[model samples]
Target: MTRSEATASTTGTPEADEYDVIVIGAGPVGENVAERAHANGLSAVVVETELVGGECSYWACMPSKALLRPMAALADARRVEGASQAVRGSLDADAVLARRTAFTSDWQDGGQVDWLDSVAVDLRRGRARLDGPRRVKIEAPDGSTHTLTARHAVAVCTGSRAALPDLPGIEEARPWTSREATASKEVPGRLAVVGGGVVGAEMAVAWRALGAEVTMLVRGERLLPRMEPFAGELVAEALTEAGAEVRTGVSVESLRRPSTDRPVTLALSDGGQLEADEVLFATGRRPRTEDLGLETVGCEPGSWLTVDDTCRVKDVHGGWLYAVGDANGRALLTHQGKYQARIAGAAIGARAAGVPLLETDRWGAHAATADHEAVPQVVFTDPEAASVGLTAEDAERRGLRVRAVDLEMGEVAGAALYADGYRGRARMVVDLDREVLVGVTFVGPGVSELLHSATVAVAGEVPVERLWHAVPSYPTISEVWLRLLETYRG
Candidate 1:
């Protein structure tokens, strides 16, 4: 039978409104899972209460990048002598906000919904909860409810939400989460950003460029604490150079805003107080499983779902439940979540067809081994920070005998030509026992595009001798590879 015919035969049947796969959440991860299942001749339906494209499309990735790009472009131009002469004015905050809104399609999901229809993946606009094994109860926006049974699997991809601290008067103060930070139409004259992770650092760069006096108050000693120490140090130095305040080793004791018209007063942990027109609490994220009725399936509500490499939930019986993306807590990155979705969808399809899951081993078609070994990320600050796989500290902690090679990016002909006074660093950690790179980090302008090559090297575990044969074109930042190799040899 044709694919559509096969899907039609199994979906919305008269006996019971059932599908081969009932995917909870219509985010990118959930969408990929449903699409893959449908491609494998299984009928799939995705349920989402919010926008179909989810956080990345609206609040996190798309809008955030849209806001950051203009500033980065201007900075790039300022680094070049002739271009710097032409760049005269500050960023137009209104124009930047308009561009950001345009990227989000003004917060509408009609296009995403249309795409789902085109792919033959049914979409149910509602909040969904686990009824039991292979069963889901959906409550529609209009208050109607229905239960759908999954013939093969039910995958939860309901991402995460910003975790606000339990500070007194926080709710009344009305702090901004990532969503508000990215979506706000107006730039506050004075903005206080809490936390120093990717969201905190990037938003600080974005708003500060848009005419806000940005002050980053980090509880930790540095920004981007998860990456190499130098990465955070570089970002903090840049933020300070750009006139934003980077205050580390500080915490908010309490927050108070007497009225909507007034400013927020933050009582600091060091017995000091500061005020800001707006405060963004980019603290952390919490899973969206509290109301998903996980208790019905013997899983604790509001807890991260434990999943194997195949993205199958471990605690649930029958092997019919799957959780991908941030829900699984494997890797919170959007790309990594999509990767897990593809693997999980294939595993579900194979099991439904009574086929043996032969590719369940490491680095196999059904396994998400990259989550543990070669996750790649790029922080899009002024000088982008990109890294893949293990950091040197991570490799050492894992008991791997590794030698780290560091190189000044300015020494590269390409980097020098890319910008005047180009300041950046590159590092590669090699597994001495294996003679392969276990980690690679690049901190410089336009380094985001250089990440995939490192991702391939780490994921492929290509031998150092073979990498030497893969020549880098001269006068490019990629030539840093050759320099790193030379440094390693010396």
Candidate 2:
């Protein structure tokens, strides 16, 4: 059925209300689950206490991108002075924070209610914990308590939270997490990011743009170790050029206060310490499965709830009870979680309808889909890194016969206009036997917009020859696609 037709219709009086599905979270992934379930003729209810858009809408991606966009535009303004006046170099910090507050609707959460109304899905304002299989207990804001038993299935899409590593004096200090970083209206004078991962780098650039001195400390030798070495190199370059210092190959030995008026100091193993106005722990995130009633449902005790190909939170007995999104500890990104939620939602709906349940597979739309294929990741810094598919090392590890090509991106016409002396990198990994684009990476200013072409080609398994026919628009940053393809021929 078309999405429009899935808008729920009134079926009964207020006294008699029941649903086919009770989704435990109203995050983006959970919202999608409700829509997909409703589309399959199963009544659904989404329970959430926080803003309905969850962490992504309120904190993570939306606000981060909002901040990063101006950084990119400012870089553009420096070149074209006429437009610079219109573009404005000085980001009214207060104005931008006002805009961010407006984006979250001033924390009023009315926008999310409108979305649920538009889709005709029911929303419950409360925190949900599992009571049993297919049972949920909700604790509401007004000190009211309620319980629900689903007629069909219970799907958990509760996302993750920032994990504070076992660092000495970390919790006592209460260093800024993503919550504080995203919500803070005032930029710290000196900021030290504890992890060199995606969150650390993104925040490092963002704070730097706001006129804050920033430093990034990474345990790994390079940034974005999940990506190819070349992509990591370009990100390191951009961070350094942005007036932030990047220190790699050093573990933070300890963190504590250097003085009463001073910021927290990170003592390094190399006998050096850097003082910062605030320390942000972006080391990683752990699944928020605590008090989730996984034990009542016969799942494991750890934060992670293991799910199979179809995203069923397979119990300790290796049976079916699925967890999707960050709760599953697989992919933490908002989009990927929504992608997996769709599969879990569909599988549950179809199975109960007495139809054959579809098994999840690499290319199958019913699976987590990105599990076996290109999972696109973009860090929305000024000089962004958008990467998908396998790396050269990943290709070789899988024992695939692969040929790799790397090209400096400034050679392209797109890069010339992107920045005066554009210093981006584009690399492609080709599966020799398959003759298809197995992987793609693009790093530089104005490159995030160029990522989808590569994602489409890689996920569609389009051959390099067919990709040649898929011409990128002229004078756009995407022409780097064509440039990299030409280098493959050379």
Task: Report the number of the highest-lDDT candidate.
Answer: 1
Candidate 2 residue lDDT tens string, 353-391: 877754655666567767667788998876789988899
TM-score of 1: 0.98
The TM-score values for the models, in the order shown, are 0.98, 0.92
Residue 36 of model 2 has an lDDT of: 84
> For residues 258-336, what per-residue lDDT tens digits would candidate 1 score against the true structure?
9999999999998888899999999999999999999999999998999998999997889999999999888999999
Best model number under TM-score: 1
- Candidate 2 has a TM-score of 0.92
lDDT of 1 at 270: 85
lDDT of 2 at 225: 85
Question: How well does candidate 2 score on lDDT at residue 222?
Answer: 90
Can you tell me which runs of candidate 1 are displaced by over 4 Å?
Answer: 1-12
Off by over 4 Å in 2: 1-18, 80-89, 258-262, 316-320
Candidate 2 lowest-lDDT run of ten: 3-12
